[model samples]
Target: MKHVLVTGGAGFIGSHLADELLAQGYRVRVLDTLAAQVHGDGTRRPAYLHPNVELQVGDVCDKEAVVRALQGIDAVFHFAAAVGVGQSMYEIAHYTRTNNLGTAVLLEALIASPVAKLVVASSMSLYGEGLYRDGSGGVHGNCERTLAQLERDEWELRGADGGLLTPLPTPETKAPALASIYALGKYDQERMALITGRAYRMPTVALRFFNAYGPRQALSNPYTGLLAIFASRLLNDSPPRIFEDGLQQRDFVSVYDVVRCCRLALESPAADGEVFNVGSGQPLTVRDIALRLAQVMGKPHIEPEITQKYRVGDIRHCYADITKARKRLGFEPRVKLDDGMAELAAWLKDQAAVDRVAQASAELSARGLTV
Candidate 1:
């Protein structure tokens, strides 16, 4: 039997991935710090994690911890990173140390004790803005909204001729436009792992996940997935807050589908040394997602509060183009948006979530990250 180690496997996506691995007959071991931000004041083992899996409580940046985690491990899935784009802007050193430096430490250990395969979790935030098409039907990858445009409330991207641009599905070929510290860290982690894997002859795959949401999400953590944030607000009997008219589009994929893709990346020889976008391949406006979550959670009366304010690094629209994943890894997202939201709502009914959205927004506004 093959033994697989998943860094940060106690968290949302990683925990689910661990379950999938265990079901597939792989012995799973997890290395995680169980950071206070995600796991609360006390770093106790999450009850949701499979009991059969071996859990190692340690920081990935610690060389001794990483070295120990790699012992007897045949393959590795690197998922240890500090999340939250807004928090990353102010806590620069924390994100850099945990995401970038942690990956470096893990890669160095892998060099000494080479794993047969390495898969790293990447993020779609690296693409600041998704691909767009001008009115002339020309595709443009280098489109960005200026501060002046944002201040004027011109939310959409436009061509040089001042014509409005339509958002196109962003493929893996699109050049990255890193807009936040978290994104930069993710990009760095992905590149570092792939480079190290190539040099060491370890097959590596990078999965650029969009918005992954399901049960066991850190509901109290305000900086988690968008759906979880909205659910927390709804559960607290507060209106879900929408930013910048809330028409900004994003892709939300089910965690189940994401784990399936991760497994495919681990097993597929064709996925070696490649990066694939793992998302639902469908775009939904932020406002629509909020409303849908409310409806599913039996809070249709609690409408979303649309705040005209915008965050500095926010993107207008970005969804996935999953053609590469479909062809290479045979990935097909089976869960529809409605079904996923319903499942999340059902799981959330019995859970208690601390409402920290207001506090988080205040912190960002104080730092001038939100306007």
Candidate 2:
């Protein structure tokens, strides 16, 4: 069996990917700190306790730890990172060290190891302001404008002869401009991975994942996206709060789709040295997601109240141009938002039972009882 080394295998997306890898007859070795709380009781859960999985509780920043885990590894999926934007702003040093230094250490270790392919988890936030360039290597303000509109629209960039320039997507051709420290760190990681791959002539693919969500995601994670938080509040009959106008859209791809991309990147020879945007082409607003979750959970009439408190640096509208991924990796979304929401609701319902068990365990522990 092929040995796969997965960093951050305890986190939401990482755990799901580990599960899928193990199911496909791969010998999965997971290395994670298990810092994120998944259970209601705030205890760290080991991602892979199965006999086939080898779990190592360690930080990726440690070169020794990374090198040790890389032994006999055929490929490495580097998914470890300091995840939230707002949180990264507060804990700058923490985010920088974990995201940047950790990735460097992993790359150094991979250089020494026999690993043939390395897939790095990158973010779409590296694209600053969503400005697109034209085919003639000129920047344009309004990318969506047509040739006729470019002639008429004052926002267009004009040539010396006043001709219209054809706009291009923010493709892999353009260098990533970091908008935040988080984005900067992630971009740096991708740069390291790419440079390292070029040096060693090893396959490297960076996946800029969109908003991925599904079951087993921690409810206590305050930095999580609006979908899970809203779903949890609605499940508890509390009013779900929406930040800003609730009109900001996101390409919320299912966790399964993200996993599929990971699997594809592992198998496809054409995926090397490519950055693929892993997301559903469909974009949904915050309100749409809230309404969908409510409708799926048998609370159709419920509507989330919009709150004035807005997140800092929250982009108004951002989605992926997933056509490249579809063409290259043969990736397409398998689950619709409603269907995914229904699956999430069912999983959350099951969590209630685990919650009870946790509460009972806590009570027994408090009483100094073995039960």
Candidate 3:
């Protein structure tokens, strides 16, 4: 495809993907709503968005807007959605309308005017918790922590015998146990698009992205990436507030690597009708990252604050098993965590960072979303 359309293309990861497409000699069109929460109530286009991209100021739910954006598009990348776990629980209808309904509207439009390929953004959040293994090395995916368990300061998921389940790399085959509105909407978006694709014979790809981080992130928007949030806290002379003992494991992938995999999905025919996990196949604890980021950003004195308080939809540990992506898409994550964190730190030094997390946490607490 010579021309591609990226919904929510003006945001952090989307903007980077657009740049990659342009560098490969493809025309890029972007449809995005400059949501007040992320864009500071501004009507101006984000400076980070590539100059070559054709920007469309519109919502994904608007059929006419989406149709117009798809006029000359050969392929589509749906990345627009309300993306937060805690906030999604309280704003259920809004999340559903923006994410689930948005995908439905886009699919209907695609049915009217078919594209060569359709790629939808899914989330690892859908897997509520990652795969786990017992002492005998029996791998399992059935795991969940109760609010009562969390309330009692029990942060780990337990097996039937009450032994702690060891976290393992979560593969795409892991059964979804969506625990939040955000995760539910992402799963709905993925399933809806794939089902529609099969019924209509449209080539479709679903990508489950793990903790993606890099440049061009809006630090003011606390919900996007955790590293951005931590950086904001450190910049504001506050310790990074980590939940559930700060020992939780996650797969933090570079945005550059994510964009590369996205391009692979579009270019490689093997990726069609398949779901792949996009992440740096390594695991790091939340505490390890916070400390590394502090050291990288030259703020080693600011220790992370491990708040024993845990959110209702929060998971204990989850990282990606990128073997599927590696075999099918020939994907490899090139950026080392040290290198990516350094790059992020350098860019963040120039950008204005603010800490709105305390207030945001209070809002969640008020809504009883946090315990």
Candidate 4:
């Protein structure tokens, strides 16, 4: 059995990926720092993590830890990064150190101890505004909302002719428009891995994941995905607060589907040196997702509070065009949104989340990141 090393394997997506890898008969070892933001104030392994998987508690930025984790590992999945688009904006140095410098440390270690395969976890955030199409069907990948437009409460992308542009399925071909510090870090990580992998003759693949949510999400962390944030609010008997009229569109993919794609990338030669967008290939309005989650959690009475506010790096719409992943990696998202949300709701019943949305929002507003 080939041995694999998954960085940040104790976290939501990484832990699920570990379970999948272990079930497939691969010896899986995880290297993670167990950040307090995700795992609370403890250093012990997460109970949700598979007991059979070997866990190495360490930061990805630590050279010694990375080198130690690389021992006896045939392949590597670089999933370690500071997640949170909003948090990354104010905590610039923290995000840069963890996501960018950490990847550099990992890459240097990999250069000394080359792995057969390297799969880097990237994010769809890099694509600031997703592909848009004018009324005449002309595609616009460079469309962006100006501050003047945002100040006027104009949410949707507009063409030069002042016509409303429709959001299209964003493919890998769309040039990245890094909008936030978090996005810039993710882009740096992916590009760094690909460049290092190519130079060192290590087969590498980058998976630009959309909004991934499921069982192991950090619900208490307001900086997490939208679904988890909504769940946290409902769990606390508060209405889910949404920004910018709640019409912004996003693609939510199941963690199961994402890990399956990870495994496919690890095993498929065709995925080497390529970047694929991993998502459900379905778009749902933010308002729709809030209502669906509330219904699933048996809290339909708690309506979502639509705040006419906006975050600095917030995108109007961006969903994946999984044609590349489907055609290349044989990846197809199997979990429907309803089923996935139900499963998440079931898990949330037994979970306790501290309501930090208000605090996070206040911080952003204080920093003028929100309006």
Give per-residue CA lDDT, model 3, range 292-361, as digits (tens). 9999999999999998999878898999999999999999999999999999999988878767899889
| lDDT for each residue of candidate 4 in 114-161, tens digit (9 for 90 to 100) | 989999999999999999999999999998988888888888899999
Off by over 4 Å in 3: none
Cα lDDT of all candidates, in order? 0.94, 0.73, 0.92, 0.94
List clashing residue pairs in candidate 2: none
For model 4, state the Cα shift of residue 30 in Å: 0.5
Q: Looking at model 1, which ten-residue stretch has the lowest summed lDDT?
A: 146-155
What TM-score against the true fold does each predicted structure earn? 0.99, 0.81, 0.99, 0.99
lDDT of 1 by residue, 105-159 (tens): 9999999999899999999999999999998999999899888888877788999
Give the number of colliding residue pairs in candidate 1: 0
Counting clashing residue pairs in each candidate, in order, gives 0, 0, 0, 0
What's model 1's lDDT at 60?
A: 97
Better of 2 and 3 by TM-score: 3
RMSD list, candidates in order: 0.8, 9.7, 0.9, 0.8
